[model samples]
Target: MTTTAAAHTDLDGTLPPLAEPWDPAEFETRLRAVGEERYHDRHPFNVRMHSGDLSPSELRRWIGNRFHYQRHIPVKDALITAKLDTPALRRMWLRRIQDHDGPAEGEGGIERWLRLGEAAGLERQAMLRGDTVLPGVRLAVDGYVNFCRLRSPLEAVAASLTELSAPDLMRARIEAFERHYPWIGTEGLAYFRSRVSQGRRDSREALDLVLAWARTRDDQERAVAALRFKCDVLWSLLDAVDAAGHREPA
Candidate 1:
């Protein structure tokens, strides 16, 4: 039996016309376009990073602030996991949390990010203490956390669609680091390397879910919007990181 959007159920009381969901191919195309237009990969800071133009201190400042985002990923995932409707779905979502937090300390993405911090010459303790995290960066990261916490599960999953573009970005990052930022060392590239494969897998799963669950025109629009919102969050993060911090209060 074919599965498609259920009968017209207005998202709000106004009862917008019960438009058919877009064809899967069209829906996916629309989703991809959000990243094409708004993804943080286009942010000036990322453009500079990939071009190998950022000074070491500039790069270190970014890594330090980025730690908050990295560490909070599992927290947001856990919140979504709790809201997932099925055990199997929860199990699948739980893997994302584990991917970052791991079953034990000294493992997982957070640990790798810490290694990245160390390679960038930021003290491990300082990163852990959140000392170098600029106020703007903290606010942007918190915005992401609050987005996941407050949005519907479908929208939350859709937001993670940022992963779709992450693999290619990681590849470019690895090459950029190897070629231009030799001071960070091969060891520091591990996070980006691991993400190349992880991003592919995670994005495929997320895309499948978004395509399946966004069953109405409203759902589809919201999913696309959620993806755009996530992209904006990422862009905002780079904006904060790339700006001069001299005037910003601690």
Candidate 2:
């Protein structure tokens, strides 16, 4: 007897229902599966962008819209940081905000992102302010901040598990953008390049924190759910751009 595709409700029919509670090992497997199946690596725009198939104008749109998420990372970290009671944990978590906001004014990841914006023909000040960002993007970012505020710290850190998979993606994006958008100036791609190192370091630290502290089966389950929520946050942000009537620059 053969089962039809509809018989399986989840992305992989073989897996258990996403709503079901699970042990730590099973939860981790499902969490990683969520990344594998639904992460931005599978986003259509990303596939086109990385394959050098996107036109210059389309590339500009991606950078312009993505600036909102970039600008919100520090804000998200700030929300998480405020909940921490330990000076040591706060000190460790503070680096994520600093990485994006920079050591001083006019520097750091946010500044690097602005350089990409300028190269893409967007106004640096406007992008920095996130003025023209999509409503969905704002909703997703604010949800992330609230998730950190409302959830356990381990779960909050787990939501950032997307970073674990980002280093490689960032490297690929740097190479692809450099190759395809030569007129945009290679130096402007430094934001992607910097993420390769920063993402790996940050993700490793966050992963250690999550896995070490989330000790119960329920804790593990909630942590995985948090990660899935964060993945949706990312996925929906890109979907908003795609759904906004923007297509690969024709």
Candidate 3:
């Protein structure tokens, strides 16, 4: 994606300009529009995956590289949780960490994702070590974690709004994996199935927090930029995976 000067400078490089404070509904519309235009679901790599066109190597590579992002999910959520001022908000955010990390061993989203990697022929130990993740994928995932650690709590929560688009993607991915990649057993798809409900609940909570907290025009603009930044992180991860597929084999 091209980053035009206008795109970065629209809000004067610090905050986005809003003509006026947006009502909750309008703010939501704007946030959804950002996802519509920039979400990773539109990336060619994902499009191909959904269309049953990816090679086995491409699929495995994606599975392995994405594990890097998956493992970091709880880490980023921890950062966001730390930024919360109230015990109630912290408790609510803590569920996100628990959702990914689970309360016990051999469970949770990370474990489920490793099951997916194993289904794709990746070694669980190597994936857990992130040994096969591409450099670009590493950079993108790390940037997101750092963004959450450094940005304001509200902006960090807004970045998580990408969850709004995740349920649909998870549904499509479950169907595509079953239809096109039967070699990947149904058990491996547990991650996607669980995410359908989790994504909706998480996105709703995050969106409510953003809407309630972002009261000023500047706050709304920053929230939008935060979401856009997150979209870029996901898009860039797919871009790296796509580029890797096109490179000549050694």
lDDT of each: 0.89, 0.80, 0.94
Which wins on lDDT, candidate 1 or candidate 3? Answer: 3
lDDT of 3 by residue, 1-250 (tens): 8886576655456545446899999999999999999999999999999999998999999999999999999999999999999999999999999999988999899999999989888999999887878999999999999999999999999999999999999999999999999999999999999999999999999999999999998999999999999999999999999999889484
Q: TM-score of every model?
A: 0.91, 0.85, 0.92
lDDT of 3 at 229: 99
Q: List the residue pairs that clash in candidate 1.
A: none
Clash count for candidate 1 is 0
Between prediction 1 and prediction 3, which has the larger TM-score?
3
- Whichever of 2 and 3 has more TM-score, that candidate is 3
53-134: candidate 1 lDDT, tens digit per residue: 8888888988998888999999999988988999999999999999899779888999999999899889999999998777
Give residue 244's lDDT in candidate 2 (0 to 100). 61
Candidate 2 C-alpha lDDT tens digits along 1-250: 9997577756765755444456556666776777887788888878887898876656666677788788888987888888778999999999999999999998899899999889878888787676768787778777887888888777788998998789989888888877777778877888888999998899878877876776666777788788889988888888877666463343
- Give the range of the ten consecutive residues with the poorest summed lDDT in model 3: 9-18
Once model 3 is optimally superposed onto the true structure by TM-score, how far is the C-alpha of residue 163 displaced, in angstroms? 0.3
By lDDT, is 2 or 3 better? 3
Best by lDDT: 3
Lowest lDDT sum, 10 consecutive residues, model 1, at 4-13
| CA deviation > 4 Å runs, candidate 1 | 1-16, 245-250
